[model samples]
Target: MKEKQFTTRAVHAGERADFSQINSVVTPIYPSVGYTFADSHELDAVLGGEQPGYVYSPRYANPTVAALETAVANLESAEAAIALPSGMAAVHLALLGAGVRAGSHVVVAADIYGATYSLVQGIFTELGATVHLVDVLDLKKIEAILAQEKVSALLVETISNPLMKVADLPKLAELAHVHHAKLLVDNTFCSPYLCNPLTFGADMVIHSATKFIGGHGDVMAGLVATSAELKAEMVRLNKLLGSSLGPFEAWLAHRGLKTLPLRMRQQCQNALHIASWLQTHPKISQVNYAFLPSHPQFELMNQLTNGKGGGAVFSFEVRGAGKPEIFALMDALELIQPATSLGDIYSLTLYPAISSHRSLTPAERHKLGIGDGLLRLSAGIEDVADIQADLAQALNKIGHGFDG
Candidate 1:
């Protein structure tokens, strides 16, 4: 048979044959913490990696989590994938799996998620790894840093958070390979439905399944897709670190993946419409969405995303407004929810200053162009007109004060 389309794979890729008595269409959740071995010989073989079978502990692998891993791996075109408890766990394990050890040097994008920034600066640095945080948009600067440092890995986001800066993944991958460094991309923002970094030469693709992959914002999970060798290494580290995802959450994430292509398409459409509307509004000073022509990486985004537009998220600045006005605007919204997590069925807005990037100091945030007036919008599957109306009314409140 010919290769199945993306939507088809999203729906059926990792499902097993319906051999049970019930013969359900959906993969049933296996919540058992332990699986009994058939015999001692089988247990030993499985533990020693000589055979393919489950052992006693869920940490080794749960059927549901393995299904999630397989589905994500197929989506990413990776040799294998491992599901974790959260996105941070996946990032940490991916770095370690990619050979980031004590005394190793790594290069990370300066404008990444705040928790990621803290991970490198606070945790990895303490482990004896030297980290160089640079503006990844400037290839010259990255090359300069690579020349001076013996880096083990180059980490960056597929589409940066809040700022919506799209990285040139292929170029970065080339640079990392030339420097004998592995390229690790945080694909949480774009998701595999929108962009697969591994297909563009990234050594590993990481996702916070808590967001797009889960779709509903209920499950907290993460995934790392990579070469088979790295997958093994990450699984080993995952076992040692005890970062295995629960069977229930993994099942939920798997259920979410079945509709990822559908949800992502609607979300992307909504984002494009809302972003375009915001761009023309006098109350908005700037809109940062890769699909917008004004975006510095618009052409690159088109090429990378296959002209589908940026993913579901974009950020815009309220004209002449400070934190007070931004808060009032968020409070005035009737439909759009004021929240932190994204990729839900309902439109949600987040303030980077207080939420995703709050770990960064004020000076650091300002340097990265994440101003107090900037608000990140995660467009949902709602009718574009209704979403636009909510935003317009909120902006009006910002103009006339909260009382009006």
Candidate 2:
């Protein structure tokens, strides 16, 4: 069909376009543990990597996962994609596959997921690689950092969790390429629907498919998108490390993929509405959705959100609040779940200082700008008014026990 468009390919690629296996439009999961080979020649070809087909264990490459990877890769316009058990696996594979070695320098943003920050700072740092943290938006500082250090790769989120900082993908890509360093964009926050880092010259794109790509928060999965050469290395390392996404999780992820477009659009709209309302709310100290006019990155967001709202996550500081007040408001919510993870059908909220980013030292938190009183909101499918009502009630009773 000469299909080259994002939506078209997402629905068609890495799958039997007809999906007539059972007269279903969505791709069906192949739950078999292993595939039966027609003959030894065929089996040899499959094992030898001579042809693309499954013959052995499903974990190596399940039809469902292949379909999911193909769809995501096509949507992101990448050469190949790898699906893993969780987002951490995806990040680990990308860093490992990029050929990071002892004495290599890895550059990361300070405002990363808490676990990831620990992994890079705690493990990779000990393994002989140097870690450099910078605000991804600070091009001047990034340039200076790159100029001073021989960085192996640059890693950042497309739109960061809680913070909603949008990286300048094109500029970062140029900077990386100039220094022979690779750029890996963690697309967990925005996913392919909002931004494809590959289209901007990023060497790789990582996703904790556990987030928006899975849509329903029903499964934990990770994905790596990169060039063919990179994919081969990742696959090799993935197999060696004994980290593979299970067949069932792969199936669930495939199902998740089918509705990513629809889910993301709705969530994006809901988040914008919520962020806008929160900005004007008297109880809010700061609203951080990129689409918000008050956001420092509003102009950049307009240029990069592709006319879509920044994918549904943002942080709002509680006005006149310390840790106790923030906790009170979070606990007061009725509909919104006071949760840690984000990107789901149901709304979720958390305080990074106490939740995800708590592990970091005070100095680290200071550098990352993770405030103690911050309340992050993950807008969901609920009506914006309902979400606001939950928050209003929560806020109403926040200072009720004492004084405002």
User: How would you encode candidate 2's per-residue C-alpha lDDT over 270-377 as one tens digit per residue?
Assistant: 889888877788777788888887778887777776778788898887766778888888878899998768888889998888777888876677577767667888
Off by over 4 Å in 1: 1-22, 400-404
The digit string of per-residue lDDT tens for model 1 on 1-46 reads 9999999999978666554578667777887665556688887888
Query: Model 2 — TM-score against the truth?
Result: 0.91
For model 1 the TM-score comes to 0.93
Name every residue pair that clashes in candidate 2: none
Top candidate on lDDT is 1
Runs with alpha carbons beyond 4 Å of true place in candidate 2: 1-24, 400-404
Position 265, candidate 1: lDDT: 94
Which one wins on TM-score? 1
TM-score of each: 0.93, 0.91
> What C-alpha lDDT values do all the predictions have?
0.89, 0.83
